[model samples]
Target: MDADVTDSAGTPADPDHRAGDTPQGRSQEEPGATDSTDGSEPVPQKDAPQDETPQGEATDADAPQGSGDEDKAESSDENKADREADGTGAQTWADHPKDGSASRRKRPWLRWAALGASFLVMISAGAGWWLYKKLDGNITTDTSAAAELKVYEKERPTPVVMDAQNILLIGSDSRSGDNRKYGRDDGGSQRSDTTILLHLAADRKSATAVSLPRDLMVEVPKCRTGDDKETREQFTQFNSAFELGGTACTIRTVERLTGIRIDHHMVVDFNGFKDMVDAVDGVEICLKEPIDDKDARLELPAGRQTLNGEEALGYVRARKTLGDGSDTERMERQQRFLGALVNKMQSNGVLLNPTRLYPVLDAATKSLTTDSGLDSLRDLYDLVRSMRDVPTDQVQFLTVPRQPYRQNVNRDELVQPDASELFKQLREDKPVAVVPADELKEKEKAQDEKPDDTGSDSESPTPTPTYSGSSAADDLCEQ
Candidate 1:
């Protein structure tokens, strides 16, 4: 059985109710109330029908439910207060603290990415530094050998009619170590294996590169070797000047032979030249004759061919069984090969690829000994920058005109009138007007004008003049 129940505030009754003692002093004793003869309290419920209505009364179950709800409300209030005090709720970044955890989480990836980039940069820098140091260790700087050098001053032939410029570019073969296998190692002394002279116009419009034959017989000057303790001065082959007095002596000898002053000089070893060729991915040339020069360890068939370091060197150094089997012919080949090499280097993007170019430069500079001026990086860079703009066509390669010696069959001497005219243009910085047809006419005219068939009255042509200038090591390839 159920009874109508009202809350303490006189509200409507609820559906579910519990048994509770009523406020009035009655036990189902009011009028129209249901009987409880079994002596059990009747539970009040909102859905059940009531027998009597009490004044100002509602459902009793509601009263008890209200007390439990009030307790829950207080607990909820306390939770809200705690959230407000701690400043941590379901708010967004706007309402959160400036240094809040959620705010920090916004750019977590960006931070990680920045850190990773920095780490990679550091690693790259470290690797570069380590590699630089390692490579530096392999370099050997020996000025002691250079100190034993002697400098000689000599009187050179003066140009009476035509002035000429002569530059001697020396590639040393002090191959006392491993350089012997590449070519010959005459145990006499270290000498310039490769020598090329480049002559530019006084106006700087045209240029001619002349390769001096290493086997050419020339009078070498007396040079002193070592200090007072073990000093000795002697006359020897022209190449011996390089070993006796180093670059200074070599420069002096060339200047003495040729009246022109050398404006600049560059020297590089075998490995350096190879590296430069490799950096350019090799050079292309047309080989008309099959070359089988085992001395240089180079063998190649005739045709359009691409040459690497070994083949290029071989092509320049090959003298035996090629052309006229003379040093003069070899110089011609060297000049042509060098010109082709220059063209190839420009076309292959050596300047554009820093990765490939820098290593070559380092290798070259490390293996070089330049005049003091070009020893520094800035100086060398400037020189290269100036030449960088010169077109390949402007660079012309030629040799000093020469013929077999009249007295010595094995030696070569300067060709007469034609050779003198060539030197005159070089010294004056004028274009070499060497059209073959025109030159032949001039030669025929000079021959016809000879007072006697003996040709005794004709003035002998002078040799090329060399430059006597300060040696500045500014053209090192690395710098």
Candidate 2:
């Protein structure tokens, strides 16, 4: 039987942290043996819960009796060392498992995606606001026109259809600034090169554009000019109103001629027109013959080709070189080119895409001069938004019925009943049916040649009067 052993202070010896580090029978191997260094006792394992404890740890219960402050200090130091060696219970974002074979979760990827989406949303919001302000600032408000029109409010015709809209689009020919390269300024008098009356139906299903002849004789009402002087009302050439009294005069003349209230107006300059065409990457046209016009600055091979900004402006503005060289035919070419442009925009979804639409709006607004009603970006947005869904076929382009004036062969006069009838339909927001002019003429010629099968002289039922016009849906390539 082994005799019980005790240390010098009469205290029992305890186990080492790792069992048998200093063998339990060391004393038996050497009788009356004591620790040679400081005669102090080592820590016991009872201070820490063994199962729950990390490796190389100690607890207060394991501390020796009469251990005092010296033994407690030794136990505390061991506990701290264990924590450092085994790793504290804290992790960082950069931390990863030390094992090479451990798999990573896809949760991090999901977090990354959410962060990217939020960043994109914030960028889009900021970009949208900036674009809105830019487009708004680009528009030049026609305050003078608005003010002058207000002065003549009593003489202005009242709007017939409250929801329907009538807007006058004028192409300005002022030889100033960038346009000086095209022609001499001629004392800076502004002229209306092209004027189209655009009517939007209350249902937002149809839009009609009527091209008014510049040389057509029309009655001009009294108008205020830049000098604040009023011009006498007289029967004169339609475009003279613009040269004499600017947009206000032109608006008064159109209002008087059609007897339809003008809701808003936009005057686009030559430079703007070219820029807008380039914005859409040019418009495609199928020319019957090749064009080479020096004055117009256009030279292109015919048969299914695209026209850039400069070429397009020349094509639309060149009068003496295309077709019969008459302003009448020139107007027709303008209508066809406009139709192709509209088709390009709708077919390519430019209006629906913000990125694609911005450049076009930017180019257009830079040259646009509009009334107070349309100067704001939101106002213009609402206007285009209403017409965005209108079918291409419903967007009609036509010329007011006109014939060479009997007195002056160089001038034009409106054909009696047709012009009045067209204006009446627009005023009432009624649908005016239209057919291609060539097709209509061909039908008339065919009818005249073919013998009538019906022998009855009895009058047939009156049919709807379809106007001779073209729509954006008309394919120039097919023609």
lDDT (10s digit) by residue, model 1, range 108-192: 9988999999999999999978766654443444443334332122343443323233445678776756566675566735667
Candidate 2 lDDT over 306-422, as tens digits, reads 889999999999987788888888887898889889889889999898888998999989999999999988898899899999999999999999999989989999998989998
Worst 10 residues of 1 by lDDT: 468-477
**For model 2, what is the C-alpha lDDT against the true structure?**
0.82
Root-mean-square deviation of every model: 16.5, 10.7
Best candidate according to TM-score: 2
Cα-based TM-score, every candidate: 0.60, 0.75
Off by over 4 Å in 2: 1-123, 442-462
Deviation in angstroms for 189 in model 1?
2.6
Model 1 alpha-carbon drift over 4 Å, by segment = 1-103, 128-168, 183-188, 199-207, 215-219, 226-237, 376-379, 416-479
